[model samples]
Target: MTDLCVEVERAPRAALVRLEGDLDKVSAPAFRKCLAGLAEEGCVEVVVDTAGLAFCDSSGLWVLVEHQRTLSGMGGTLQLTGVHGVLRRVLEVTGLRPLFASQL
Candidate 1:
């Protein structure tokens, strides 16, 4: 199994969550908690940096989708950067690309 790591950096206007390793079922809970923490902190703008994301399963995709929906409902935004390889294809194929602003 691929190890997962999440690094968060908060800025004045937004928070950057850098994801590394595999984001599968085992790690989705951590990702969700991170998002929940951001929400509780009243963060309105979030940018997820996928520079080190090695793999993302369907569960990971679900987390992203749910967070994006939640943020949009609150008039916030979720931006994705460094999306490539299998993860990129998954987003495109799943038609979830429109849910986030991609900086690839």
Candidate 2:
């Protein structure tokens, strides 16, 4: 299995996290840590680009849900883009689609 890799580019208003490979139990902590670091840096808006993400298990989804809650509490937002295939179906099936902004 390909190891999960998260590439982050911080902008003045938002942080873009491009995810690649599988986001599962082993890699969820890394993903959470990246988001936490961004939050500590006063990043309010986060855009997760999932174009290259190959897989996402429940643990990964849990991290994302928690992150969204955290960002929302800080008066920020988490948006997702390039979600398709299994990831898209997962969101839809889990009724988590409405949690993220629809645009992009």
lDDT of model 2, residue 7: 92
In model 2, pairs of residues that clash are none
- Tens digits of per-residue lDDT, candidate 2, 1-104, equal 77998999999768999999999999999899999999989888999998999998999889989999999999999999999878799899989999998453
- For model 2, state the Cα shift of residue 58 in Å: 0.4
Cα error, residue 34 of model 2, in Å, equals 0.5
lDDT of 1 at 75: 82
Write down the worst ten-residue block by lDDT for model 2.
95-104
Give the TM-scores of the predictions, in the order they appear: 0.94, 0.95
| TM-score of candidate 1 relative to the true fold | 0.94
> In model 1, what is the error at residue 79, expressed in angstroms?
0.6
lDDT of 1: 0.89
